[model samples]
Target: MNKGLTAKGRATRQRIVVATALLTREKGAAETTLDDVRAATATSKSQLFHYFPEGRSDILTAVAEYEAGQVLDVQQPFLGDLSTWESWQKWRQAVLDHYIELGQRCPLGSLTTELGKSSAEARAILTTLFTEWEEALFLGVRTLTSAEPEAARIRARSILAAIQGGVVMLQATGVTDYLTAALMTSTDPLRPTAEGTD
Candidate 1:
């Protein structure tokens, strides 16, 4: 989207995207309107149109990208450096905490739900998020286990799946137990006591 724009223009667009993301978080992507985004961001209709030429769909797409980035961003520090058992535990807690806190209001969940109604682009965005998340977990698993690379990869994917499944349940039931259990059990195997070590 940012094919060519000056620093100021990019910043303006980002501001709109961020505002739209927040609005989507509060009021589901399907319900948020361009007018609401404009009011929240204080951008005029022309300004919004300037940044998102295709109108609401473009803005929603940008917001989807923003929310997707956030899914990984929250797991940072621990997610980026899961070299030790402690880091893995912290990463698990981070994931659990995020979902538990948001519960039914999960922005990614709502955004995907709405986006799923209209385009394959939404599915692609979700696939990309999961793929990246799995890769990170895979790398982390490799660092702590001497398991074959393929085995570690499967474990990583399992961890990612556990997270997604737990999140769905959390959203449905407004409980953290599901996510906590999923993360704990999925990550317990990589604790370094079972096989490999630092």
Candidate 2:
């Protein structure tokens, strides 16, 4: 169970998280200071501590989780239901469009990399995000074929790897070619075999 918090408290906390995320995205986590977050959020030092008692680390973890959610939220209806070929295509386009818009900046990746050095919690947050993402892909894969659960699980993991690889390349080159090829090749198996074709 969670502790009860007033509406205002929740709003304040959300404001802080949103402000912090924005700052981190723009300035990179290593350069963002508590004072920066406080000023941007219009929060006092004590108020910041009231929400994040562990200080900068705690706030960074919250921002990491928020960014993780954004990764999935952008996928939307397509990600939730990839049972059909059309759905898969839509999901791929959504992913490509998102990265294209984001260019080389990956908020979650930057946050985790910056905070992961000293915070086990930051690593755990990233692990949880990847786990959930893989599970979602697994479920979607199962819908496409009668393959065994293990096989579907493997395929899902490969798909995730492809996406990550693409993102990494995008970060390095500021190009979408790798990501586009990754999504296409990874989803190729999901397409139904044409009549009498293996």
Candidate 3:
């Protein structure tokens, strides 16, 4: 999308996306309008349309992508290296903390839910996010276990599912118990065994 833009053009486009994302997170996709975005970003209507020719849908899609990146960005450092049990715990805590901070309003979840019904592009963006997130967990699982590739893949998927389910529950109940339990139980396969137990 940024194929032939000058540095300033790219920055302005990014500024719009970032501001729109923040607005959506605060007021929700349905509530956030193009005018809201323009006012928030201090961009003229022409400039907003220039960056997002398709209007609100295009802007929402961009915000969805931005929120997707944020899902992984928060889990950094620990998510980058989950080779050890300690590292995995840190990642788990990071995930929990992120959701707690977000509370019931998950920007990515809300954006995808709002747009996925009407836009294939939005669904694709969500699919890509899940694929990359699961792959990162798979790499970490492989690092921590002697499981075969297929087993590691299954384990990683389960962990990802657990996390997603927990997040949903947390959003619904305003409780973190489900997420905590899911993270703890999902990592059981990687728990250290007793001495000389094979």
Candidate 4:
């Protein structure tokens, strides 16, 4: 249970977060005013301030956390449990399909950019998100390769870096080839060796 939240409190917070997420996605972080959030969530100013004392920055931070969760949420069971090649493929497709559908506009990207990704708080949030995401990929890679766990961790970081760089290029160009190449190339080395007539 989340210690800070009563059931109703939790529900209200979720409503605010989801509403903020949609507004950010649709309007970009720059244009999503507190009034917009208030109207979208049907939340009173007092209630919004009660839940987030720091107002927009606080809500933006919370929304960033929410969006971070969402980035992987679409991958579902495959992202959670990647013990098989089939699961990896599914996860890959989910990630690709998600960005493809989203096109150049990325709510999460907008939020991070608006919040100053270089800031200590923003970096910390991103670090946590990437850490968790890389861990999931690391486990799958380890399972597939039977390598040292640490090796998998290193590879996972590399893979994550590649994917992030790819996503940046993708957002700039409205192209997905960079993302696809990043994932494919990162995992290419992990492909099992097979005997051939040579």
List, residue by residue over 101-182, the lDDT tens digit for candidate 2.
Answer: 8877765446445544437777787788789889889988887675689999999999999988888777668898998999
Return the top candidate by TM-score.
2
Error of 3 at 26 (Å): 2.7
Candidate 2 local Cα displacement, residue 172, angstroms: 3.3
Candidate models: Cα lDDT each: 0.81, 0.80, 0.81, 0.77
TM-score of 3: 0.86
Which tens-of-lDDT digit does each residue in 2-40 have in candidate 4? 368799998999889888887877777778899999999
> Could you give candidate 3's per-residue lDDT for residues 21-56 as a string of tens digits?
877766778888988998899899999888889999
lDDT of 1 by residue, 31-148 (tens): 8898999899888999988889999988887777888888889999889987778888888888878877888877656555665443567667877987888888888878777568
RMSD score of candidate 1 (Å): 2.4
Candidate 3 ranges beyond 4 A from true positions: 193-198
What TM-score against the true fold does each predicted structure earn? 0.86, 0.87, 0.86, 0.81
lDDT of 2: 0.80
Segments of candidate 4 deviating more than 4 angstroms: 1-9, 115-120, 193-198
